[model samples]
Target: MKKCISFLTVCLLMAKLTTAQIIPSFEFGVKGGMNLSRFSHTATFATENRAGYLGGIYARAGGLGFNFQPELYITSKSVTVNSGSTQNKATFTSIDLPLLLGTKIGAFGVGGRFYTGPLVSFAINKDQNVGDALGNALHLNYKDQNLAWTFGAGLDLKKVSIDFRYEYGLTKQPYNNGNDETRINLFNLTLGYRLFSL
Candidate 1:
């Protein structure tokens, strides 16, 4: 675990330095938004959209023709179960770092982002004892660390930007039901600003 973290840190620093040397245009920004996520299991189960938050600092380099952007941020995500009007929620927090390859054509810009080389997380809290939500005690088991995948696109304007991305869960939801893996897939749309380097 220590080795992995160290390696990732080195890689990120190298990428930043390399991008600075090769590209001329650079922008730093802050972004925040909601994540609409759904949890799906092999059998029928209930799930709901829980409120989530994401904030990060990003560096955009290179010129109008082609560019590379990378962001480091922390995100909050959760999945809820609702049955017959009763609901239960499980929330997890993670730190994510993503790198994007982007291009421009006319007024519209498009890009593909590769997210999740590593994620560190911990369980903040959960609701299992709420009656009717489960009617009885429910057992949950999960690990604190996970690796996830995110793929998506965005629209870039001169002063503002809008981004859309989808995240997929790769680790099994730590639970005793071996066949059941907590599946969460979310689409994120964010509003951002170019805080530095116009």
Candidate 2:
């Protein structure tokens, strides 16, 4: 009976150690960034890219090799369009959510990371000033929801992180009474600081 109890205790301890080793560290942080965006298809309208900004919070789970990150942010995007003698500007504000999977390579509080993810955006507001002729001709309307794919690389030094990412639109916005569609692409740079880790 004594031998059986001793063996069981040892087994339990080993299991606990194994479980601890498998779990990864967790981190929470805040981030903000600037972005440049343009419409993919301008058609008759000449489109010019415009600068935008975003600010958000993020959480990361994992260690040295593989990590999962999820983020929530508010972003503003804009573009200027010119058709013949008419010129107009459009701006969109939205809430963005991104779910990313990443791989890290480095040690001793410094690392390089590569990540890819899907992002979903919900539009909070859309503002555009169009000429009467342009509005009637294009039948322009803004979408309430949008989707995209994000690919990026980043560097982490101690508690600070910097990233450069490109977002490709996976969905299209319809216009011209649904006869035409357009997609938007964006490039952004972000800076982040770790708030806490466990």
Candidate 3:
């Protein structure tokens, strides 16, 4: 009887450990990447896309199948604008906050993830130079706060992650004294590594 009881108790403990291994958990990481961004509007000035850099930290909850992630990053966005014969750049430096929900599929330390979320951005530099021609013509005024929706897919191999995402602006910044507005769009690619798991 003692032998049988000991065997059953060990089996139960092993089962509990197996269950914990399959359950979702928490992780935190850091990421950095580049972004290609452009402005969208009906303005007469021609706009061109520009590349910029971003770096940040992210925390994720849940794993195995589903996860919720929140990230904070600093990003630089820019566009080159041409007004007839003159050309200049308009750049914005901002802090970004993104909240995302994602699903993961795969096994054996490798997986693919798809996520979508909302992002809020606060501009660190409110003044933008559009050149004398475009600035005088549009009387551009930039807003301090902006919002967007982002969607992305990623690949995870062990502790490394790579993601590609698109951000579509939902709010417009007014120019010409609130009479005209424009939105910003971006494509982002990032590489991240897990710092730890809990």
Candidate 4:
């Protein structure tokens, strides 16, 4: 494990060197937006989208047409279960980090931006027992970590950016019956601003 970490560190150092030497459009930014999150079921499960919050900070490097962007965010989202006439929701607060590779979509890096990558999330919310609107006890098993695939597009307007992305879960839900799988997916639209440049 230590050897792997050392190797990755060396690779990152090489990338930083290459970026610093070849490209100079480094920027640090902040973003905040809303998310429409829901569960995508494989079987017959009725659920609706839930509104959530997303806010974060990010750093950009390598910008002579292509760049690498990594962001850390505090995100809140939920999934609603349709049980008869009453709706039950499970909300999770997570720390999400996405490492993306992006490139300019237009002329000489002046057009639009496209990015896609893996998102790592750790649920900061703990296990709790709650009652539904009709007073049924709900027991939950909490899982701390999840892996997701994220892809998106953005328009860069100098110091600001407008982005849209989708995140799909690669694992099972934290709380579920063993009979089927419940995966969550979210649509995110964000507006961001570059606070500084390097």
Q: Please, what are the lDDT tens digits per residue for candidate 2 over residues 87-165? A: 7677777777788999776555677889999987766633432233223223322245588999999998999999999
RMSD in angstroms between candidate 2 and the native structure over all alpha carbons:
10.5
Which regions of candidate 3 fall more than 4 Å away from where they truly are?
1-22, 126-144, 174-180
- Backbone clash numbers for all candidates listed: 2, 0, 0, 0
Cα lDDT tens digits for candidate 1, 1-198: 999999998888767655544456778998877787777554546777777887766777766356677665666787786656667676655555555665543322323333222222323334422231112112212334455566666666766778788777666564323445676667777878888774
The regions of model 4 sitting more than 4 angstroms off are 1-22, 42-44, 106-110, 127-144, 176-181
Pairs in clash, predicted candidate 4: none
> Per-residue lDDT of 1-198 in model 3, one digit per residue for the tens?
999999998888766545443687788999999999887856586788899988989888864457898887888888777768888677767778788998876655677889999987766643533243223223322344688999999998999999999999998755444565688899999999999988
The per-model lDDT (C-alpha) reads 0.60, 0.79, 0.79, 0.75
Q: What is the TM-score of each candidate against the true structure?
A: 0.61, 0.76, 0.76, 0.74
* Global local distance difference test of model 1: 0.60
- TM-score preference between candidates 1 and 4, better one: 4
Candidate 2 worst ten-residue window by lDDT: 133-142
Candidate 1 accuracy as TM-score: 0.61
Deviation from native of the Cα of residue 56 in model 2, angstroms: 0.9
Inter-residue clash pairs, candidate 2: none
Q: Over the stretch 1-198, how does candidate 4's per-residue lDDT look in tens digits?
A: 999999998888767645543666788989999999888864456888999998979898875667899887788888787756766677877777788988765432234778899877766643422222102111222244577899999987768789999998886675443455577899999999999987
List candidate 1 segments past 4 Å from native. Answer: 1-23, 82-86, 107-144, 175-180
Residue 106 shift from truth in candidate 1, angstroms: 3.0
Worst 10 residues of 1 by lDDT: 132-141
